[model samples]
Each structure stands twice: as C-alpha cells, then as structure tokens.
Target: MAKADMEQFIKSQLLKADLIEIDRQLSVTGINDMTSMLLLKQAFITVSNLVDFEITIRSIYREHEKLSSEYKSSSKNYEFAKYLRNKYIGHIKQELIQKSIEWKPELRYSLKRIDEPGMMFIFNLFILETAINTYVNDDGSHKIFESETDLKYPPDLKRFLIYLSSTVRSAISYLSNLANAFGERVEMLDASEQKIEHWIAAGETRFEFIKK
Candidate 1:
C-alpha cells in the first residue's frame, strides 16, 4: 500500500475514535445546555458515536495488515460497546432478545433539577443494569422520575469511553509509526484542518481494487 493511503485510512479511523471521546465529554456539558426534549434528540447521536468508534477500530484491525494480530478484540468493555451499537444502530433488538432468553433489554437515565441560585438540570445514565438504580440527594429534591427506578442507560458509559479514547490515541500513535516501515512520513499532517478540496487539489484518490 502507498504511504498516503495508509496514513489516510488509518488516520480516518483514529479521527472517529477521537471524535467519540470529544462528543462524550461534551455530552456531560450538554446536560447543562439541553432541555428535556433536546436531551432525547441528542442522546441517540451521543450513543451512536461509541458505535462509530467500534466500527473504526474494528476496521483498522481487520483491514490493515499491520494491526490485524497486534490488537486483541476481546473484552467485556468492547463487547458492551458493540452490544449498544447492535441494539441501537442495528435495530435488531427483537432478534437478539428472541434468539436468547437471557438477553433482556432495559434502559435508564437520571435527570434532576439543581436549584443552586440559578435553575439547572443534572443528567446521568444508568443503562444495562439488572437492578433498579437510584441517585439520591441528602436533601429532598424535585425529580421528574422516581429517584429509584429501573434505569436502562448504562451509567458506566463515561468510564468505558475513557478507556476507548485512550486506546485510540495509542492506536493513532502506533499507526503513525507504521509509516516509517514504508520509508515515508505522514505528509498530510493537517488532515483535520483541510477540507475535501485540499485532498483533491493534492492527488489523493479513493482506493479501488485491481483484481488479479
């Protein structure tokens, strides 16, 4: 493979991984800015970002010869990530449920008002837990839903994403070094800064198969 193509494809996946990290951080910040209705709308894309991250890393692992055996794809954290991707993005919840009796699907989230001088709302997730999860305040606070309720949103999501983000950053660095093996440096250092026109202006073309 050519140096430019290797750098481009690998970096592309790394970007997706990095973006998922940024988006999740912003999601916490989002709760402060988002209204109840807006929360519902933004939630899907936020969760979907993890799904995108999964596909990116998997692609780099499978398609790239260098990373194929180097990265192990086995982990509960990784599986949970793919499970969410499958449930929400794939839309095969019923199929999964019907296929296995143990696979029960539930969703939960925590939302509460924080009236500290200025009115504000705090949002958190408690997804995929078997037992009803609760977020309690020492003082009684107004809540839209019961404090202790069967919540489905995975609370561990934020933590899981932290693992993912760090992993991807490592992968990006690892991928960059692969360029040295090709006897070339990553020429397109400012890929994020450039628009599609920049690549077109340069000579990067889409990868096409040449069957033997």
Candidate 2:
C-alpha cells in the first residue's frame, strides 16, 4: 500500500470504530487528517517510546548531539528535544528498576523484579494504554492487571512486573482495537505503505491541502 492508501486504511479503521469524523472527500483530506491523527496518537513514533534496544541505542548514539541540543531549552529545537527528553526519561526508569535489584544484594535485600528491556517495554506499553483508555471514553479503571498482586506499586517487585506486563498487553489491546476499526490488520504494515514516500517526494504532505 502507498502512504495515502495506508492513511486511508487508518481512517477507514477509525471510522469503523466510530472514533473520528472525516469529510466527504476522504481520498484527499480525510486520509491526510487521519495520518496526522495516527501520528498524534502514536506520539510521532512508529512504535511506543520503549523501542527495541538496538534501534534505541543506534538512534541515541547517532543523534546524541542533535538530541542533547534539543534538550537545551534555549534552542528552538522543540521536536528533537522532546524526543530526547521522553526517551531518556524512559531510559532512566529502566535503569532505576535495574538498580533497585542491585541494591538488594549490596544491602542484603531483594527486589521484586529484574530491570530488563522487555520489562521496560512493558512499562511504556502501560503508559500508552492508560492514555488510550482515558481517550477512548474516559474510563480510567481499565487497568492492565485486575489483581493487586505483590508488585502493585513502585519499589515493589510484583507491582513493577504488573506494570511491565500491562504495558505490553495494552499495546496489543489498543492495536487490536485499531485493527477492528480499520477493517484491516494494521500492525507493522504502516512502514510498508509506499504512499507516504510519494507524498513526501511530491511535497504534498499537508493534510488540509493536497494538490490533486
């Protein structure tokens, strides 16, 4: 699929969910708006914030200077800065979980869980899920885990595990919701769509105005 077609698919999916309103000319304006909406929904990343370690490391290493400058409030580089901030913050959280366990041995204590990337990914997944559930209709009680198990809060291993598990689960759940809406299996296919490149090449990326 092309970018336009992919956006069209997204819009159609959202429409199927009765989640958004598109104009009559869905071929043009609707797809554009829908693309923007999905970008906003995913917060401009192809996946959630806790990306795979290899990609994350490469991204940070290659873009560190640009990212660091973005972090500096004085610069007008708002987008890159925000990206760095969010990603680094997520990194910090992961580190904290890891350190918490290390603390156990030195202090002759034990923590609830290990701070692995899968767990970190799950944590981010939870945050996204929380935001989505809140947006879907303001139902906040829809938690990733229904039970108040051992790790129900921070500083506790069981709670952290729940948090991580919930994160991964939520991504899956919301994506499933999206798939049902678009009438197509949208997972991982967004990148394969060629229309996005076509639009960029033609400099017709604006949603409100596309030169037909």
Candidate 3:
C-alpha cells in the first residue's frame, strides 16, 4: 500500500477505535436501583461515561474543524449529554462544596446520601436509631447495616433510572450512526485516492494528500 493509503487506513482505524469505546461504555448493563446510594453512584458514573463518549465523537469533527450535516442534526442530544455531565455529575457538586465551605468557613462538605424524600427519611431514621444503640454500646466501629437489602430503593428513583437508561441508549444510537457515517466518508476518500503515476500523468502530483 502507498504511504497515503496507509495514512487513511490508520485514520479510519483510529476512528473505529473511538466508536468501539463508545459502544463498550454504552454496553455496560446491570445498573439498577437495588439500593439508594448504589443507584445514585451508578447513575453519576453512567452520565459521566456518556459525556466522555460525546467528547470522543466531537473530537473527530473538531479535528477537521468541520461538522457533518448528520452531526449537526443531533446537536440537541450532544448538548443534553454535556448538560447532564457538567450540571449534575461534574460541576454542580464542586459548586456545592465551595458554597458550603464559604458559608460555614470551618465545616467540610460530605455527601452522605442522595435519595427521594421518603427513602431519605427512612434511611435517616435507621441511622438515628442505630446511632442511639451504638452510643449505648460505646462501639465506634460497629457496622451500619448487616445486608444491602436493609436499604430499600424509592419508586421515584427506579423510574428515573429507567428514563436515564433509555436516554443513554438513544444517545448511543445517535452518536454511533454519526461515527459510522464519518467512517464511510473516510473510506470513500481512501477509495478515491489516485496512484502517484496517475497523478503525475495528470500533472496533479503537486497537490498534497492532506490528512485531517
């Protein structure tokens, strides 16, 4: 293969690797609300992974400084993925920590739990009761709960997880299609490349094969 063909093949392989990563992340399953804390943490991780996938896809277009019409059409999905990442998973928590420190000036921010109102109340009640018992016993290292099933997940959380799973699947499909289209364009360019002899015969060898 010619040097130019080798370059195009490498570019296509790199883009395919990106697509495979996106697919692998999206293929992550078994994220459900078995426990409140576990569910919240998993949800955060899922959104973060989706955001990374979007960034990978964006990098391909940004490298060339041009966006395909298909990618342009799915701009809303990309924006929403970014919003979920920056607002909920990434920046908002940092902002909350900063605000807490500014307001108290001596207290540290700690995320103990995230759950619906009813579920939070139940967990708080359990903790309060357990603390009382442990205080009477004077055991500082006692376990909080014997089993994971001790904490029940809220209905609202279950519904939200379902919605989030659907959203992630939709985003993956949209982004995968865009990546595949990009691969197709790359393949077309590689197929359209002329041999050095042919280019010389046509007096077009002066043109460079610009790899983007």
TM-scores vs. true structure, each candidate: 0.35, 0.25, 0.35
Which has the higher TM-score value, candidate number 1 or candidate number 2? 1
Give stretches of model 3 more than 4 Å off: 1-80, 92-153, 188-212
TM-score of 3: 0.35
What lDDT score goes with residue 197 in model 1? 75
Against the hidden true structure, what lDDT does model 2 obtain?
0.34
TM-score of 1: 0.35
If ranked by lDDT, best first, what sequence of candidates would result?
3, 1, 2
lDDT (C-alpha, whole model) for all candidates: 0.40, 0.34, 0.43
lDDT of 2 by residue, 1-212 (tens): 23443454454344333212212122233212334333233332322322321122233324334433322322222232234235433333454434334432322231234264344434433333323222222554423334322222344444433333333333333334434433332345366665666678688644576574
Q: List model 1 lDDT by residue over 98-148, tens digit each.
A: 422233322111123333422322222222221112112366431222343
Residues 67-136, model 3: lDDT tens digits: 4454455454444444544544345445543443444332332234334545444433233222222312
Candidates 2 and 3, the one with greater TM-score: 3
- Which runs of model 1 end up more than 4 angstroms from their true locations? 1-70, 73-76, 90-212
Give per-residue lDDT, candidate 1, residue 25: 61
